[model samples]
Target: MKKVVLAYGPRGFGNYTFDTETLEFSGSPDTRSGPLIIPGFIDIHTHGAFGIDFMSATVDEMRDLCCELSKVGYEGFLPTTVTAPVAQVRQALARLPDDPMILGFHLEGPFISPRYPGAQPQGDIVDPPVGVSEWDPILDDSRLKVITLAPERPGGGDLIRRLSNRNVKVSIGHTEATYTQCREAFAMGARHTTHTFNAMRPLHHREPGAVGFALTENDVFTELIYDRHHVAREAAEVLLRCKPESRVLAISDSTMAAGVPSGTHLKMWGLDCHVSEGTVRLADGTLAGSAITLLDAFRNLKEDFGWSTAVNACCINPRIALGLSTTEARTYLELDPDLNIVARYDRKK
Candidate 1:
């Protein structure tokens, strides 16, 4: 059988044959329609899917999340915790199992701006870690990979420097910071932006906020929740136009409400949220997270943008942000003519 592989070279797809019995490539390339093979998706920022919230899920429940995600072609993911007390965050981080599919953990934060808490637990929002207190045990968790905070807040810069020193990605989010402040944070060590253009200040002609910097900067990895509701096509197009393929990280900042039917009300990490037309939001209409998987993101981006846009943003870029081995990146999907995932498997042993 012939297959279209794009991971090797992003310029375009190349046709290759596979022996059905041996499950290995058997023949040279040919120019014809065939199943598409792209790298497996890696979700660096997902709260949960299929009704499980990582903020409170047990190890077994988290495994169940993996099973659900794998069905759609996810090779790896980071379990993200919504804003909560420090002790509570520790409990959430400690329960994760040592599974290959589980990459690390993301803290969406206790260290965020109350002015732009979004759907996070507002009352639990705390100051950025100063690294000199007993209540900061959550920072000691080896599995902690990413932390999102408001750089305009006190100690935010210091926290970014410290986390960066330890190789933990500091993603700027939940802020009302100006472009100058955003630039300062970048210079101080923040390298990622959590779900750009959401839960942060909007751009102005005179003072282009965090969104401006995220769009124009080539070095920062910005996360986009490609679910159309979270970000519009025009805005996403602008982002794509300004940043290179390598710097744009598409994420499924999904929550328990994701994939559930519209109007389904659920408590997400203690906040009442509901789904509506595929967008998850709080009671006051603040977008809680998203109701999309990487598969959904990939399809939307591929349909709206192009194949390479989808492949780089959904599959490869997140891995790059996490410092994972791309050459050995396993997990590939066999797609039919309609772009449906017909088969999924590991690519490299």
Candidate 2:
């Protein structure tokens, strides 16, 4: 098999070679493309896009989402679930066909706090199943990568330990957990934070809740939905400066309402939401989610921070958080000086 070389620079990382057939890295750089090349994006958090919710998607609909995301430079993603009944969540997972683009499921649900529920349905928030074998379906699924929960909830700590012991990554979010609670969860092996600063308790001088714990705890990884609407530029800068760039991950946290017309109305998880001015919002103006693609997030970050920072957050950072190996693919993007996609060479089976 011929190895394809991806040369990207002005920032100078030299070339990266990949075996076209297997999409695995070959190490030595040989030139097949030049100027700018980057790995395909890995989105660890996203509900659905183009009007499909993973929670209710048919097999075809889920596969279609994979195709749509691939066109936008996403090589892998996690189909996130909103707070729902265990049976419903299980049904969605059981029905979802295995697609190459779907790395895993990010269960962002029922095991959360009702106080900081954000866009999640309040009625669905409940204690995690306490019985060790109760969630065997989820615990046994190899594709179950991450689970986000509020540690302050009943049985949250035990569940966290159980999931971590099973090799599932636990993330803390959608909570009103105090600083002490956050620390305890971190100690229990919840190493990631889901959409930091949005649904969690805010940072206060005396309190310093989940957000504070994420920043202070160097071992924890933080996911930021850097779509301007979700996190302001100034605040993003603060996060960037405070946390090691490698420890921070950029996610879309997008809803199915993304990519549709601006005025399109969407009924998400039984709540009425509409896409307006590139943002999805509730009827009362609470921010629903972002319509921004991973590409859009990269472009926005590059314009604001510079190439290295943007690439780190969008590409490198996610890989680190997910413990992904570089040998996964040889796919590369040819980007212009301004970081726009000039062309792309994808490795398709």
Candidate 3:
């Protein structure tokens, strides 16, 4: 067997040295310099990667995507769904992979506003019927983690209550809800916002839409797409300022266009989308989604907003939002002078 010396610690410290041959650790007692190490990025909202679209991907395809993502430092993610026929949505869910790394499914639409539908297909939008029980089967599964809905829609408040009672995270997004409506939804148990400041109402002194509510409310965990295109550098800094630590989650909101080099048109929710200038837009010039992954977003946050480190945008706060142990959470890794992954371990596990 080959013996190798491994360095381990947060922020690329060589303080805790380990011999990989026997899995025994020791103190290096010397400072090492090389690549900056960070915890495996967790993306709670991602649709697909490496040319696979989650909405139509088979179980094997989803697993393939997860395996590819692992190479890029993504440890886990949610398979996001767009507005589609109920039958198609159910079929997609039925075909999901059972791997724990897949985490769960984030249903992004089908119950959102038609006016600000963004990249979602307009034909697939539907209003929830009174006493609708169709979503119960989908939501009953342990793998369904979060659902995004417009709070002002018909029966949306009740839906939020029911989903919250079931312990499923309900996020407000893709809507035109007024301030009062947002407040009522928060009172009823909406605890998160989807891609704050995009595809939702903007914050105005008089209107105080979802963005305003998210900024003011203490309990809501707001997800910011830090791709720079989604939110400007100054705007992102302002959001981080208003949102309390542990209450902010930086998400990718990535689409199938991620990881692909550039200048490629990909199909998103049945619409043709092209990546240009680091933003994914539909053929008709509507903003579709993001072309960057969570890792890229973290780097952008650090480079643009001086966010201290990638850990500040990637691991620490997201873990807290997911109700994981922050003290024990792995945020970054220490690299030896060679810039290799020395020894790796998670803070929680």
Candidate 4:
């Protein structure tokens, strides 16, 4: 029998020296220098990875995504659903894997502001059905982690309150609500904003729409895409300045084009699409979604926005917002003496 030697630290592995076959730990720590290591990334909102769209994925396809994500250092994710028929949504939910790393499900639409529907099909938009006493059965076995809705829709505030009471996190998105309407929803328990500025009304001094309320509220967590295209670098800086440390959660909002290299065709929201110059758009000029991943978003936030640490965006803050236990092993990178990646093992491994 052999052993492995690993040096662990706060962010990630400091050094790892080992014998592969024998599993023996040996030699001085491999000291190489590199970018600071961070915990394996977690994505709160992502529709798909590789070429498999979540809407169309079978249970086996989701398992494939989990394996693929492991290679890229993702520890967990929430499979997000776009606007679709209720029956179709239920069907997709039925096929998800029971893996713990597949944390839960995020319903991005079906009840949203029709005016700011973005890529969601206009046909799918609808007022919440009356007297739907329980959504639990419809969601299958997956925990309903988060739901995005337009607070201005009929009974929208009531829906937020209902979900909140059931311990589900509520987010406002794809909305055209005025400031007062957003604030009212917040009072009733909408605690997050979905991909903040993308499918919501822009911030204005006069209107103070969803973005405005998100900036001002200390309790509301806002998900930012951080692909540089979703929110401009300068504007992102401004948002960072306005929101509190506990209220900012970075999400990939990634589409099926993720993980695949540039120049791949993928179907999105029932339309053929391609990734061009980093943005995924449809033939009709509709901005489909992002092609980037959570790790890429973290890198962009650090490299472009001058963020000093990934903890707030990546770990501590998001866990707190979601009421999740902080017991998971947090990973990060550290440069060795020679500035290289030192593969270290930790308890979670």
Candidate 5:
């Protein structure tokens, strides 16, 4: 491991100490110089990493992905699913592993808008008020924690209400809904926004679309991808300025290509995508998903915000969003004085 340079705590660098032998980290700004230690992150909205795609990977492969994520800094995460046919989606959902690190499952599509499909295949997008017989099995899955949809399509409000009543987190995304429509959805139990500002209506000055509502609504949780490409730093500043730190969290929205070598091409959702410059994009250059982990987002956030703020965004906030105890993370990511990852220790066996 590299020698000491800085420590990231409430007070910043040089306030902590680490013993590589004992692998213990202690802090407060006056302790002997050592590595920067932080709680392992919980990503609520990641697709896959290390060449694994949650949409198609077997349970065993997903477990392998979990072990790989642990090496960086993640303690738990949702194996998010993309839009697909009902049978296909259920088959994918059925593959979720019952691992402690697998927090839950996120149904990211099949009930979203076609107008703002983003990288989601337009053909697979389904309108609101999903039929009960087919979707009931999906909704009944105890591990189904979140579902993102546009609340303006047919049966949108009803679908939002149904999911909310079942304690499923309803996030607004991929819609051209007006401010009033979004507010109505929020009233119906939509409390979050998916990958805020991407694949959502732009925040028009007068209209104040879904993006505007997400930023201004104090109770609305916003998930941001801070890979410097999905969302620019200035936009993040605006979001942070408008919402409380607790209501703002970070997500990777990463694709299988995230941890793979750059320039690698793969067929994602029946489209050609290539990883380049840490981004997976289509032939026309539309972003498929990010190519970064929560650790990468944490580093980017700390560059703009302080270390304390970054920890909240990357570690604490996402867990809180899932109704999990913020104190549950025991895995520690140890970074050298320069904050480079040196090692990680999982205190919880």
Candidate 6:
């Protein structure tokens, strides 16, 4: 292995150094003429990018998507699943590529609430089954990292405990659960919330729904899509202020339309999604998944909030959220003051 050191920042704020080979950081400022190094972005929630959807992608297609994501500096990612038939979801999982970039799988549907199925195929949405035996094929897979579901649905709390007992992270999302219901779910073993305020119930003063619960609860980690379109800058600022730095996860939630031209039209989730004006929308004008990548979210957070918030949300929080170990080789994105990825240093390479 090569002895590589990456340096960034100026005086006062202190210099950040990364040991590419060991994937460790040294805070002591050093006068080294090297590019700024940030942890390789790990996107915990992403459907697809580069005009490929994980739900219908072949192994080669998924590998192609992985290559495309590496160009944008994603060292690790979770190939998230959308709400689809149980059989279809199983097929998708079986077909996932064994790329080094693929940390695991994020099962994001089927057991979600139809009432808050934002852009999800409502026809396929259903309540959790009474037992985990019915989904043994999925639950048995050790690669299953996170599963997003509505805890207010039938057998939802039981499912949460079952999945948590197996060491699989459960996230609350696409629900109409109020504060009390969310608390109950948390007590049952759900420790995360998907996309924060998007598909769940709104934060009412009297009700303090899922969004409210996620904010006030320190133990619960919240995933925030920093695509300026899915979440406004002002709202993101408010989230940064309200949530603890360690508990906020910055995710892309990007779909197939990302990395394509604005005029591109793609079919996803049985709907015609058009990518334009930095946003993705269906024919009926409902906002679909994001067109931004984790890199974009990192830049947005840094620009909209600050470096501290961006690093915590994009880098440190993701690994903590998934309970992943970084003892293996890691990749680092060497960025400039403008947040441009000028170069990359991969320890494995």
* Backbone N/Cα/C clashes per model: 0, 0, 5, 23, 2, 0
Worst-scoring 10-residue span by lDDT in model 4 = 1-10
Query: What is the C-alpha lDDT profile of model 5 across 251-302, one tens digit per residue?
Result: 9998898789988999887889999998999999999989999988998988
TM-scores, in order shown?
0.93, 0.91, 0.86, 0.85, 0.90, 0.92
**Model 6 ranges with Cα > 4 A deviation:** 1-13, 16-27, 30-34, 325-329
Tens digits of lDDT, candidate 1, 1-349: 4443433333234555543333355344446455677768999999999898887889999888888999988999998988887778778877887888999888888888898888887898888767596445666667779989999998898888877899899999999889999999999999999999999888999989999989988999999999999899999999999999899999999888766888899987777888899898888888888999999999999999988798889888888899986644567677776778888766544
lDDT of 2 by residue, 1-349 (tens): 5434454322234565544454445454544454566877888999999888899999999989988987888878999988887789899998788777888899998889888888999997888778765566876788899999999999899999988997788999999999999999988989999898899999999999998888888888899998889889998898888898778888999889878899998888899998998899999999977787788888888888876777778777787777875434435666777666666567775
Name the best candidate (by lDDT).
Answer: 6
Q: What lDDT does candidate 3 reach at residue 47? A: 79
Model 3, range 1-349, lDDT digits (tens) per residue?
A: 1232333333233434443333344555266443344456778888787778888888899889888876666667888999898889999988888775677789899889998788888898877545847766776777777899998999898888888897789999999998899989989988899999999999898999988988988788888888877788888777778877667788888888888767887877878888887778887787777878876776677666543434555766666556655434333343344334354443343
Worst 10 residues of 3 by lDDT: 1-10
Kindly indicate the candidate among 3 and 6 with the higher lDDT. 6
Compared with the true structure, model 4 gives a TM-score of 0.85
Name the lDDT value of residue 68 in candidate 4.
80
Worst 10 residues of 5 by lDDT: 1-10
Which ranges of candidate 1 are over 4 A from the true structure? 1-12, 17-32, 347-349
| Alpha-carbon deviation at 181 in model 4, angstroms | 0.7
RMSD of each: 2.4, 3.2, 4.1, 4.9, 3.2, 2.9
Error of 3 at 231 (Å): 1.1
- TM match of model 1 to true structure: 0.93
CA lDDT of each candidate?
A: 0.83, 0.82, 0.75, 0.74, 0.83, 0.84
Q: Show the lowest summed lDDT stretch of 10 residues, model 1.
A: 3-12
Give the candidate order by descending lDDT.
Answer: 6, 1, 5, 2, 3, 4
